[model samples]
Target: MTSWVKFTVSIPDTHQDALVAQLSTAGFGGFVQEDDYIDCYVEKKKWTSGVQTRSREVLQRFAKEYPKLELRTETTDVEDRNWNAEWERSAGIVDATKKIVIKPSWKSLRRRDKGKIVLHIDPKMSFGTGHHETTRVCLRLMEYYVRRGDHVADFGTGTGVLAIAAAKLGASRVIAVDTDSWSFENASENVLRNKAGDRITVHKGSIVALGKRPFDLVVANIDLPTITKFLGRLLTLTRKGGVLILSGLLMTDLVPVLRLINRRSIIPLLLADEGEWIGFALQRT
Candidate 1:
């Protein structure tokens, strides 16, 4: 039998996105978000002492940053059993847009969904199952901005859902980059599962790997801090007058992120919100 470590973090709703971002960067996977907290799980064999220390550090930092929230965390050891069934039970069909329906490989599509675009995704250790607000908003923005034959770059391409969507939406080519090797591998599997192997390229690296290359459209569904950290690189990788879709921000994070956008001289064309999460579409001048 296998064992897993589970970290349950309690935080104010406003700080959920930020905490998720921190936990993701710390190498935690398999997340379930609740109204007042988040549960993150990792295999015991993979959860090293360093990872545990890092997780504590993240909690400490967030607690200090949001003192009023009184953020807290608890840990437990879980005996692994039938994770696939659990994931299947938790993940249903996600209607990202009128034209886009995200369904797990295990789920059968209805007859009415025949003509609509379907993305078959098997959620593994990576993110972006199209169930999260950030991913849904990003897909909607992709539907609105992607043009036929356009080249796209999907930063932090967790599960490669956005990259696959860009390809299904008529993008000629897509470059999907993620820093996590697991996400890179998972996204690769999803791209092949979606039959986008010829159109989408998966790279295991951060935005720095993009270099000076520019794309017609760039979509990043990552947290605010990571977004801000790579803003300059993202701007440089987007062609002049190209579209940039950014998500994974809480409503409270908007003002500061918008200020940064203004400083870059990019003007946002649209602002979209779902629940507490927000996304933006900007045009590079």
Candidate 2:
């Protein structure tokens, strides 16, 4: 039987998101943060020696970035089981948009959800549920930008929620891309769960691999660094006058990201702010 490794990461400082981003990049998912520690889960097979080395390297680098940051990780072996079902029991339905709802696979909708579009998401080993501010903001942005017959690209499509939402919202073709193996697999399954497999194709790499296809809309709900890294190319991938949505940024990221967008001659048409996270919508025309 396959097992799971739970890393109870303890941090001495409040710069937890930095570690969360690093862990996500390191292919760890299903993060549960608490007052003093964060729990990160990974499949036993993928918890290779190389992954451990890379994780240490990230911590060493993070020490330099945040002088007060001190990280301690303790690993626990977990038996393979239906973790998603456990999560579903506690996962409440969220009205991601007025017309769009996000619910777990086993949950039944109430009368209030009538006429709403429900996305049956199962994040077995990925980091996207509609509960986070970033995810909700990105979904809201899609509500405004995703048009009927639009070709959309969702970069870092964890659990494929945004791509599925785009497909449900009327995008003719939706391409969901993720670099993490778990995310790719989880998103692919969610795509099938939502019955959006016909319209959404899950790609297992960066957006660059998809070539120069003109997408009517491109959404990237990843961290600030990742967003900045691909902002230029993402802009180019969208057709002229098409929409681009960027999220997963802390409030501190506003200035630099806005400056980067300004340099590219792209003007943000809308700003979606939820808590400390903010998302922007830009039209390439």
Candidate 3:
């Protein structure tokens, strides 16, 4: 019987991705974005005063940037049973792409979708359920690049969606890494549910968990701050001629991120933009 904390924030859609990423790092997990408001939920045991303060700081920073936007904030306590029902109602099936379909374990698939590639993801408190633009961007790019017998690594793999997809897409092996315990557990469960235990291994640590092994395809679908901090390490983890996919980027982050990328010897292959969110596919030199 785990209680939950719900934060209801009203802001423009333009800043949603940045908010979601910041909240994720701040300890908030479950997210639901509506037309005018985005609701963030976290287990009460994990949402400490520090997390609340950080969440407020995130909103204040956004307010400073867009003073005219009506960014209102509301906080409430949700009972465990209540949150479960809410999550189920909002967790509908997502037809992420022509070939990829993501659905929660509680839901059943349609007859028409029986032929498509399916991912049964129960995103308890983690991310990457293919409900976000960043997830979809990375998924499409992975479909295009993952070759047979290739090894893949999914950094900040929230619910192991991308890692599982990599295993199904012909990767010989997949490593999914997340530093947070919530994500690590959720991803581990998903990997087993997808029957990718033989091909995918979930690690609960930083990039160091990957050791010195280079991957054929590396994906870091994390926020701007994380990407900036580990860009060099991320590049080093990709072998020469291997591919790296970076997501959870807002359009505003492109210039600074590109400046970082330009410092390296990587070749950009694809840029998929969905609204203000985008994902980059680059090849190591």
Error of 1 at 215 (Å): 0.3
Please say which candidate is ahead in lDDT: 2 or 3.
3
lDDT of 1 by residue, 1-285 (tens): 989999899875666766776687677868777789888998898899888888888788777767778766788999987767878877989888888999998889988788999999888878888877888989888888999999999999999999999999999999999988878988999999999999999999988765568999999998887888889889889999999999988787888997998799698899888887899999999
- TM-score-wise, the better of 2 and 3 is 3
The TM-score of candidate 2 is 0.86
Task: Name the regions of candidate 3 deviating beyond 4 angstroms.
Answer: 1-3, 12-18
Which candidate would rank higher by lDDT, 1 or 2?
1
lDDT of each: 0.87, 0.82, 0.88
* Candidate 3 C-alpha lDDT tens digits along 1-285: 778888999876777766787677778867877877888988888788999888888788767766888888898998776545666877889988889999898898998897899998987768887778889999999999999999999999999999999988899999989998888999999999998899999999999997789999999999888899998899999999999999998888889989988899999999998877899999999
**Rank list by TM-score:** 3, 1, 2
TM-scores of the models, in the given order? 0.88, 0.86, 0.92
Clashing pairs in 2: none
Tell me how far candidate 3 lies from the true structure as C-alpha RMSD in angstroms.
2.0
Tens-place lDDT digits, model 2, residues 1-285: 878889888974366654675677766757766777888887888899987887777788777766765677799999877776667665778888788888886778989999998999877767678877788888888888888999999898988999899999999898888888788999998998988888999989988755699799989888777877887799889889999899887677799888888888686899999776799999897
266 in model 1: Cα distance from truth in Å? 0.8
